[model samples]
Target: MDERFEIFLVATPGLEAPLAAEAAALGWQPVVGPGGVTITGGWADVWRANLWLRGATRVLVRVGSFRALHLAQLDKRARKFPWATVLRRDVPVRVETTCKASRIYHAGAATQRIERAIAEELGAPLAPDAALVVKVRIEDDLVTISLDTTGESLHKRGHKEAVAKAPMRETMAAMFLREMGFDGSQPVLDPMCGSGTFVIEAAEIAAGLAPGRSRSFGFQQLASFDAAAWETMRTAAAPRPAPAQFFGSDRDAGAIRMSLANAERAGVAGLTRFDCRAIGDLQRPDGPPGIVIVNPPYGARIGNKGPLFGLHAAMGAVFRERLQGWRMGIVTSEGGLAKATGLPLESGPVVAHGGLKVRLWQTGMV
Candidate 1:
C-alpha cells in the first residue's frame, strides 16, 4: 500500500474550520484541529493544497512518525528515515522542535539534539536560516516530524511588488471573502482599499485564478517533486477570464495606483475598477446588493483615536444612509472604533491579523 502522509493547513487558530472546508472542497478529507487541519494525501495532493488553498498560511507534509522514548532513540530513528527523499544533502536545513507532555520538554535543547543527529549521522549541513526546515513535535510519547514544504508563508504570492501602509495579506483577504459567503458573482467593493488586496482577491476568485499561479514554492526543490506533473498542473490551473465584477476606491491616489499595478500584475485589471475616490463616492453597483468589505485604518497607524472617531461615525452614517440592506464587512482592531459605526453589530469572531486582534463585524445581510 502507498504511504499516506499527513498534511497540515496552518492558520491563525480561529480559521481552522474555513481552511478545512477549503481543503475538503479540493477532495482532501480534512480533520479540523485547534490551530490547523490534518489530512492524508499523496505528493500531488500536497502540491495542490499549497497552490490552491487561499486560507492556509502554510501546508506542512508529515514525513515520518515514530515512538521515541528518549533522545538517543530520536537521534537514531531520525537518521534512518531517508531524509534524502525530501531534502537534498547539499541544501542546508534548520531543525525546530515543540514538546508537550513528553520526555523531551526542553525545545531548545531537543532541537540541538536533532540538529546534531542529522549532521553527524546523515551528513546534512545546518544553517542558521535554512531554505528547508524540519518541524518536530512530541506529544504523549509520539514523535511526528514534518517538513515545511512552503519555505515562506503561502500568503506571499510574489505578485505585490509594493505594499502600502497597513496592508492586508492575500490569504487573509481571501479567507475573509469566503467567510462572508462570497460566491464570486455579485459586485464587491472595498472602500479604503489600500493596495487593493481585498478587491484583487475577489477578482481572482471570480475569474477562477489560482492563487499560486505566478509564484514558486519550496516543494520544487524536493527530490520527490515531479517536475512534469507540476508543469501539467500549472498549465491546467491557469487563470481564467474574470467577468467585470470587482470595484474598489481609496481616498489616497497613491493607493489606487498601487492597486492598479497589482491588478495588472495579477492579470485581473480589466475585471476590477479601482478609483481614487473616498467612501462618500461609494454607491450601489449595477447588481443585486453585493458584499462590501473594507479594512480602514485604526489609531495604530493613521492618527489620534480622537480624530478617527469622527471618521468612524461618518462611515456608520454613510452605510446607514446610502447602503441600506447591503452586506457590510468591516475589519477593525479596536472595538471602540467598530462601535463608532453604530450598525447594530455587536458580535463577530475575532481574528489575529498582523499582530492585531481584528473582528469582521458584518451587518445588513444582502
Candidate 2:
C-alpha cells in the first residue's frame, strides 16, 4: 500500500497459476487469486504490466480503496483522491461502478457522483465513448476504484486488422495456450487456425515477444507517466527469437491470407507458417512431441449444427488417425461438438468468453 500500486491481472478461472507464472517471469511477484493474480509495485510497474502481461485480459490499476460507511464519505474521499495523476484533463473518461454489500448500493447514483466530482472538481471531460474507463467496486464496506489502464483490452494487439466471424481475441488465445501448459521452446500447431491467433501468439511467446509491444497504452498518457522510464522499459522488454517451430493451417484460403498478413504485422511471420490445408493434411514438423490446439467451428449458432457436427466428427477422425502421440486441446462452446471428436479428453475448466461458456477439452498424449 505504501507503493501506491493498484494493479491486478484478471484471467479465466483455473488460470491464475499460469498468469502468475507470466507475471513472475517479468520479475513481478504475483499473488494468485480465485480467478486472477494481484501484484503491487510503483507507477512504472503499472506500465510494464500493461505492456508485458500476456495472460491477463486487462490491467486494473487501483486508484483508491477505503472503508466507506455512507455515500457522503465515499464522495468526499473520491474527491480528495488524485484523479489527475491517472486521468488526462484533455482526454475524456467514463466512470463505471459495481456495488455489493455496501450502504451506497445504487450503482447509477455512485457512478454519477464520481463522474460529477471528476468533471466539476478535476476539470476532466466526460464522453460516452471514452477509451479510458474507471471501474469502482464496492465490496463489504470497502470501496475500491481502479483505472482500466489498458484502453482496449490487451487482446487488441493492433496487428489483426481483419477479424473472422467468432474470431477469438489475442488475450483469450494466450490464456488458453498457457492453460494447455505451453512452454516457448516446444512446437505449436493449430490445425484449424482460423485467424492464426494460437500459432501467432505461440510464436510471440517462443520469441520472447511482449503482447502489447506494437500498441500504445492508456498509462502512457497519465499525468504521472514518465517518458524516459517507459522507453527504457520497452527497450528492455522487447522479445527475442527462438527456433522456427510455430505452424497453423485452415481450410479457407482467405483465412490463411489474413493470418499471414497478421503475422507480418506482428513481426513473427518468420516464426509461423500458415497453410491453406484441411485438417487431414496437417503434419508435424521435426521436433519433440508438442501441442495440437484447435478451436474448431462449433455448430452452435452461426452454421447448421448437423453439417458442423460432421465437421467436428471429421476433426475427431483426423486427430485419432494422425496425431498418435501429440497432445490436443479442443475448444468449443457446444459440448456435443467437443464430444464428437471422440478423443479421450480430460475435462478442462469452463471459462466465460465471447458470449459463451467455452470449455477446453484436452487429451494429454505427451
Candidate 3:
C-alpha cells in the first residue's frame, strides 16, 4: 500500500492563498500551486482533508504519474498501474482526460484508451455519471492520474437546502472570511445576508463543527477506506460553544425564513440570529466589535446597476456612522459600487463568482 501520496486541494483561482493558509493551519505543509494547494500525505490524510477542509472546492489524490508520449504507451501503463489499491471492483468510475501541448492531443481518444484499460485490467464498470472520477492529464507527454475524493463540491455541506438568488457558495464564503481575518472568536454580521451563508459559516467555525460532517465523500467508495477509522475521526471533535453570536439580516422575509431554516439544519441556530430588515434599517447589535461581511447584489444577476449606487451609498453611510470599530468586508462586482459606499475600502483580489468577476473590498475599523 502506498501510504504517502500527493494530495491536491482544489481552490477557487483567486482564493488559493487562503486555502493554502487553511491547509497549513491544519498542520499540512502546503505548497501553493496554480489553481490549488498541494500536500503529500496518505489515505488517512486524504480522508481527513475531505472531512475538515472548508476552503477547498474539492480534494483530489494524485495516485501516480508516468511519461507516455503515445496513446499505446498510455494504454499499456494505465493497464499495468496498481488500480486495485485505490479503486474498488464494485464501484463504477468515470474517466476524464485533458491534454495540453502533448503528442496525444486528442482528449477523447486518450479517455477511451484509459477507460478500456481500467475495464480490462481492474474489471470496474465505467459509467458516464459515476460517483468516482479518475482524472487524467497529459501535459508535455507527462501523464498524471488523480482521483476526485470529493463527490460533490465541498460547498454543498449537505445542510443548506434553501438558497436565495445569487447566493455565495459556502467554500467561497469560507475563504472570504479567512481573508477578513476572522479567527472564530468575534461576532460576524451579514447585513444583506441572503440565506445566512456567512453568518452560519462563521457560527459553525466558532462552534468547531467540521464542514464535511453532514456530507458523504467520494473516498468512502474507495477500497482503501476504513469505515471504523473514518467514524472515529468524524466523531473525535466535540462541538464548542461560540464566544459571540452571529447575525444576518435581509429585507426579504422569505430569505430570512430560509436563513433561519438553514441555520437550524446546520446546528448553529442557537449561535446565529437572522432578521428581516432592509439595509437602511440595519442596526448595530449589542456586542463587542467584530467583522461585518456582506455579499450584496451586484446588479448582474439581481437587478439594474443604476439604482444600486444609492443603496451602496446608504450602506456605507450607515456602517460608517453607526458601526464604530467594526471591520467591514463587502463582496461586489463593480469597483464603482464598492467605492460608492464612501468608506475607505482597500480592494482585494478579483475572484470568479457565478461567471462574473468579483472583488472583496475591506475597510478598517469604522
lDDT of 1 at 216: 85
TM-score of each: 0.94, 0.91, 0.98
Tens-place lDDT per residue, model 2, 235-332, is: 89556758788888988999999899999998899888988999778776677778888888776556677877778877878877776778889888
lDDT (Cα, tens digit) per residue for candidate 1, span 184-301: 8877889889899999999988888888888888787777878999989877965666578788889999999999999999888999998887887777667667888989889776
Deviation in Å, model 3, residue 365 alpha carbon: 0.6
For model 3, the stretches where C-alpha displacement exceeds 4 angstroms are none
| lDDT for position 172 in model 2 | 73
Backbone collision count in every prediction? Answer: 0, 1, 0
Q: What lDDT score goes with residue 238 in model 1?
A: 54
lDDT, each prediction: 0.83, 0.82, 0.93
Scored by lDDT, model 2 comes in at: 0.82
Between candidates 1 and 3, which one is better according to lDDT? 3
Evaluated with lDDT, which candidate comes out highest? 3
Model 3 over residues 1-366: C-alpha lDDT tens digits? 348989999998899999999999999999999999999999889988998999999999998999999989999998899999889889999999999999999999999999998899999999999999999999999999999999999999999999998899999999999999998998899999989999999999999999999999999999999899899999999998776579999999999999999999999999999999998898899979899999987778666799889989999999988899999999998898999999999999889887999999999888
